[model samples]
Target: MTINDIAARAGVSISAVSFALNGRKGVSDQTRARVLQVADEMGWAPSSAARSLAEAKTETFGLVLARDPHNLGVESFYMRFFAGLELEMSIRGYGLLLQVVPSVEAELAKLAKWRNSRSVDGIILVDLHVEDPRVALATQPGALPTVVVGDPSLAGGLTSVWTDDAESMRSAVRYLADLGHRRIARVAGLAALAHTSIRDAAFADETRALGIHGELVRTDYTPQQGAECTRAALTGAEPPTALIYDNDVMAMAGLTVAHELGLDVPGDLSMIAWDDSVLCEHTLPSLTALSHDVVAFGSHVARRLFAVVDGAEPGAFLDSTPSLRVRGSTGPLRG
Candidate 1:
């Protein structure tokens, strides 16, 4: 409830508690962890009014999603990732300020306002673009501590945390190739996203190297678009034998589309999903998927932001890739 209570419970000096709670220097990491743990156990929260009067640290991190708000709430990966980010930030006595904007410029403007007003201590940037203006804005000298989520190449010198999407893409294509899937179609996420671009290029190169016909169908990360893509793919004169989707939502839609078309999953049509979620398991024919710990990825990104706030240098780091998880939805090419 109070700092005194936390100090007494933590068995540390009140000054130590103050330093740890304020994100200031002069406390050992162990001591800081102890103070925070005790504070959380004692149900202590810093008063916003009190924070304003002190050293000007808002103790908050900013995250902006330049996507449709409707989808973010329902998307399993983002939902889980957000939970992980909030968990870490809460343990560190920091709040998360999340916003959704429709345009890149608007997102940049919001970040600027937060910085100018000192409304947030740091920020997490996601979905790096091929020619991202946010990169330059975020990586400038004396800029706010930023952790960009995507490939390091897109970050323009800021701290970046990325998964090995290129390799993962290659692995997916290779897996299909091994299953005798010569004609493959990938239902990719937004075209402008750096990760999507990476996956596209890797998929093309890998397919070419393996002597397979690979096509990429772009979408806006919507189930409708996914269904449309699947319908088009299946109705083509030379339909692909195997299909890969960028997310579980789209993959499930694709599966439904296959069923609607009178196709047998893994018998006439093989399918794979990018992210492993509950949806992947609930389908009549469970989806084979490229899976990884998305929650852990979020925690890693959040910790990188904290490190940057603690004055660590900006650099790129790789998170774990999506490992292939074969399931009922994928099988050898069938005539």
Candidate 2:
């Protein structure tokens, strides 16, 4: 079906249908609604190529997932965060062009393709590394507007939306210290991620100040790696009295590993998770977590991206700080 059919069904001129469909100012609100209803009912879909040319817009945003899709597995935090971003995009009559790539170079190539093809109005970047080249790419003269979903330090001069991860890490350490956990081990995520660096530095600072013995083991945010690291830490000559994990899945795996060692959670060992999900509560003895609304964080990022697309000044914006949630998985260190 075509706009001609929609115009006929809505009892309006072809130009009127065009105005309504393109969100132009020529049509009244009632007429626009009638045109859209008639078009939807008639199964009239515009050609993407034709629509882009006519409206000078794709009405889409771009996002690249920088990792092997199979290796990444199911992550509740990202799923929820993506849903939140979709919510905002849908309300604004936009779509997200998602692509998963195997490496940082591949992700950058995807962004470049989108920019060159005019497939997106702007891009949202994730998993920033130290001295991220993406920041340099987007900050160059006449570069595409970008919103970085990481700490402001990684964004260079581009717009950024982030939580206070350093502060949050400090809080987690202090919470365990208060429970008399002197030797604490952290199950950290990929070292390349800018957040991991922030958290690692914070962990070091806090442990040093509080006179706590701390060990950090890095992983690819996989449950298997989480389990492996947990077992190694607990079976060491000098085991940690408490443990902190980068995410809920890893934390749950750590719990199981503790059991495999015939240890009691919050009795022989204490554990904390960085992100809260249903998994945290469902685990035996539950998991103490540093909690924040990830969905809301995604929404905040979307809003910032929209502002950038609208030619707003690029700057850093801090989202909600994560709060410590006490649970049965943590307790006073036993003698």
Candidate 3:
């Protein structure tokens, strides 16, 4: 069925049907309902692309990430965060257009295309870096309404929601220090990610404050990389008495590597991780780390995006504090 069929059944012109279906203001309430009923009866649906052009609002948001779809399997944080975003967006009557691109330029192209074609009303960006171009583009005049989900050190005029990653990292390191772990090692995420840099700085600060020896190693946020880094840290001349990892996936890998090396968790090398996941609970010794409601983070960011789209004055960017979750993976340092 077509718009022409619905127009004929509703006793209105095709243009009137189009206006009603697109949520444009030219149609009366009665006419809009009649058109909708006829369209529903005929099993007809309006084209989103066409409706966006006619209504001047796409009612969609673009989500750009820099990872392959298959890599999502191990990243529990993103899956859970996205699920929360989808849930909130469903209630708010907005659709998400998610795209994965290899480079920042590719992501920029996708956003530009969406803007030029009127395919999205706004956008939400993840996986940010220092001095990211997306930050500048998002703040440009007439650019799509944007909400970013990483470091808040962005160009002025954009809305951002993030956790206090540096503070949380310091807290984790202090916990180990208070437990009398002098030799602590950090398994960091990608070197280029601003979050990783923040964490690294915080780790260094806390270790120095406590007068403890510290080491940090960078990885690609993959379990394999985490395992490899864990092995190297364990086999060092003076191995770390405690290990802190950037994410739960890498923490699990560290646990596996520790077991292969015949080291007892907590007893031989204590472990802590960021971003709590189900895998942490199932490990031989449950992992302890900084934890927060990532779902809430995603929803909070989405709500902020909606506020921006609704023309709210962009105020200070929001940051959530992370709490420590104690589990079996850490213990009193062996004397």
Write candidate 2's Cα lDDT for 1-335 as tens digits: 44445666788865577778888897999999998898778876667325533423566788898886876654688888888898888887888888888889988887777767667777898889999988888887546668999988788978999999999999999988998989999899999898999999999999999998989999988889999999999999999999989999999999999998999999999999988888899889999999989988888888998787655789899999999999999999666
Query: Which 10-residue window of candidate 2 scores lowest in summed lDDT?
Result: 48-57
- Per residue, candidate 3 scores C-alpha lDDT tens digits across 210-253 of 99999999988899999999999999899999999989989999
Q: Model 1: which residue pairs collide?
A: none
Error of 1 at 131 (Å): 2.4
Candidate 3 lDDT score at position 5: 54
Which residue runs does candidate 2 get wrong by more than 4 Å?
Answer: 1-23, 26-56
- 145-257: candidate 1 lDDT, tens digit per residue: 79999998888888999999889889999988998999999999999888899999999999999999998999988888999999999999999999989999899999999
How big is the RMSD of model 1? 7.5
Find the 10 residues in a row with the least total lDDT in model 3: 48-57
Per-prediction TM-score: 0.85, 0.85, 0.83
Q: Give the TM-score of candidate 2.
A: 0.85
**What would you estimate as the lDDT of candidate 1?**
0.85
Off by over 4 Å in 3: 1-56
Tell me the lDDT of model 1 at 302.
Answer: 92
Which residue runs of candidate 1 sit more than 4 Å off their true CA positions? 1-56
